[model samples]
Target: MVEADARIRLYEPSDDKLVKFSIGKASMEGLAVANQSACFHPFTLSAWVALSCIMIQLLDWWPKPEYGLLGYLPPLPAFGCWGAVMLYLIDWFNRPQFEDASMDLLRRPDVADIAKHYQRSPSSGFFILEYSGKFVGLIAIDASKDSQSQDTLMDKKKLSSSLPAKKSQGTSSVATIRHFYIDEPYRKAGIQEDLLAHAVQHAFKADSAVKEIKATTTSLIAYSQKCIRDAGFALEKPLGKLGVYGWKLDLVVLRRAYWEKQAAGTVL
Candidate 1:
């Protein structure tokens, strides 16, 4: 069984290629799946249907022979602003994902440098979940993001620091889940769930000041949101929308007090 071979451990410099392959593939696939999921929303579908009907209507405006011959297609680019509207709409939807520096940190040989971001704070770390000696998934924590949500959105600006951009300014103690991804084949085995558990424990164990752990998920990823909810995080607030589709992301917080209470009053 895949479960028998499952192991969750810290990331290593040597895992570069495997990390890149898994992260990029899974990240892109997740993005595609999430996009498809968002398109299924009633509003999105209705808008798409309306657009299609408009396009079909426009096709009738195509030049037709005096005999009303078949196969007469319109000069699409010449027709009104539909072409420009589609181009601008696609651009608007695409910019957010590519411009998001934090997301870029998740995909590459560049991502290998993630350890540098965590090294200054023992309370933070990057973790890997391996199955049968192969890297299959990963998760990261950042002490720097204590007072704010993880910077998972794309702004027009590039990455200004090795650390994520949304770190809060304060004396409060919190840890943020910076990145988390598990490949599809290994997702439901429960071993993958331990990755989150391990990360949360490590954050609390490494820093007594860390009174809470927080993560964010978009409405597009209902399964991921459900998993985080089951892990004890409660919705904190709706941050904002992303892309032309307006997928909503929310902050969720899990307090250290709950952990100690669950343990019958033991400190982390």
Candidate 2:
């Protein structure tokens, strides 16, 4: 194992170069590849639609040959729509997802603005894991107040009914984990477990009102779910094909209580 002193710290604008390098490495590993479907993928479906429209426009304009209203009109709308759709699909596929959160972060044009967004409040912040003075991982947490956060909450309630009940006193503040990633070479070294533990501790410390930390991951990334579990979170239900997991601070307290009780009995 590569034994190096590792530390997790708040993100800084100066860390952009290390962050970008990490993203580039991930992209090369094909971790950012779009999910492919046997049946037409969404991008492929879009391309087909655009192509069909172009063909229809060509067929309509072919016989006319002259630069009249009909010939010009069909080509204009057809090519416009096709170009727009193609551009959209290109961007969509190119954008990284959860597995490559660091890449997604680096891709943003306004890194400073993004850094500010996460650091806007004590309850939210972005973090990077540095091992041996080299950044190797990153994770972020933010308050769940936006539309995406609301949607995730809704999914959790609807799908994770069977998950362990909250043992801690409930609060309105919910923190969502974002852009969690660890370098491949350094993984399986219990780094993720440590990172997650720190994340929860930081969340509780930063905002005492935060009672719960919520995370979601696709079934495809089994290691992510494992990391969450190793950090003392419980797997809830499946939200669509994604698995939902949560850690309640109250549960930690309860577990601690149980251990204390056992220790007291041993002393007696």
Candidate 3:
């Protein structure tokens, strides 16, 4: 009887243990509202569907033919702005570096909640990830029109004093890689890689308009550099005094199409 019980225990693996954290699509609707913040964007399928219908109809019904496609599209700039919003939201949610225990000790849930609410109003859409059904880590991208221009996106005060300016504005929207972290035990696994994979994949699948996905990171964590590289990001030459000084999460820049193309190549 004891042997039989031991055999059964062997067959049944523990449930709470961390399993594979692979890259998967997040259902923006299932995102826990409490975790919403400027860094995390969550949208339901129904809301997305409704927004799409309204935008498509409005775009198809423009009165003036002079602007061509732009004229036909919805005059509501907010409605037309979702692509960039979704991109940043996902990026923020998957930011694993932000989830350090020291940072969490300083961060309060109430503050995070308030921030999330402001970020998820009808005008925006945020993206995030789920670990064991908990909002363990997240990445958010805001598509608001009032964002800063390239010359001053990452102020020196925020990071190393010597980093160079990394900015581009071919379009009106900007993509911010807002948040990233892995839960305690999950960090030991390859959750970071999975998170990055999903983020780049979603950026590519979401819109054709996305030109680049930008982020910052410290010189530390050689793994992070590798992760960005595996995802197809190229490192810019070190910035002036910034290279001499060290900081956490030095600002890094990556493109969606580049990583997506490489990811797709592997599947083939």
Candidate 4:
């Protein structure tokens, strides 16, 4: 449980080491989550079942009476069953997914410098949630390069504006939330939602031109949809199949006007 001392504060230079460690830890955790969340995509299961049936059908057809009621050969059916089991094991316990996911986290810039890319933009910042003296989790948001542009109506906004969108935000003064992770032990505390709320609330209030926020999460993360939904983000679209295992990236959006209209008093 998160202690009463738990609080979300601005990121400090001293926290860099722990933040890196957490990101690495999250890579391993992400792999575990990906492995367990396979149920979310049932097609994978159906395919495995179909393969097993095919293997059984082949075994029954290949064996002859002289071959001991097995395929034409004495040990052919045994070999077929063994081969099928091995394939299932190899597919189910794949390590490529973990390797790919880990390398990506290690490459992300924020795991170390906080919002270094922002170049100290006040409207953007990294936050760490601390329980007692230990860091429980962290979330960061960065404004697009067009952050300073004049406020304009949503209908009037155009991609041709002189300023390009921050890669994280990808157009206009939008702020993209990144590296939002909580240590496993502390997730049961329900503090994740509050941490997310503070980040979003701060982003909207920090700048007026920043009328919308975008976040890239994964279909592999089962709880992500509900958590971000509770925070006022709606699934805008699917990014695509991202890894070798066919996992997907989803884009979710939260509009400033919508955030202001939430009925939940506890939502920041």
TM-score of each candidate structure, all chains considered together: 0.67, 0.50, 0.40, 0.66
Q: Sort every candidate by TM-score, greatest first.
A: 1, 4, 2, 3
For residues 1-268, could you state the per-residue lDDT of candidate 2 as single tens digits? 9776878888888887776566455433332323323113555666666685767666774335486666546555565666666556644554434334444445442242447556545767678999899877987766434302332333445656775533222233667675577887778776887787677667666666666667765434445557875555555555542111111111111122332343356523
Ranking by lDDT: 4, 1, 2, 3
Worst-scoring 10-residue span by lDDT in model 1: 147-156
Model 3 stretches astray by more than 4 angstroms:
1-125, 146-174, 221-225, 237-249, 266-268
Alpha carbon deviation, residue 226, candidate 2 (Å): 0.4
Question: Residues 116-177, candidate 1, lDDT per residue (tens digit)?
Answer: 65664677888898878877788887775333433332421345555554433333387778
Model 4 score (lDDT):
0.66
lDDT of 4 by residue, 1-268 (tens): 8546888898877887887777667656656565545433466556665665676576564445664544456445555565566445544664576666666655644443454654445567688998887788888777656443323333124543854444344334677776678876777767788889888888777767677888877755545556777777988898776443667778889987788778445455
lDDT at position 79, candidate 3: 44
Error of 3 at 1 (Å): 21
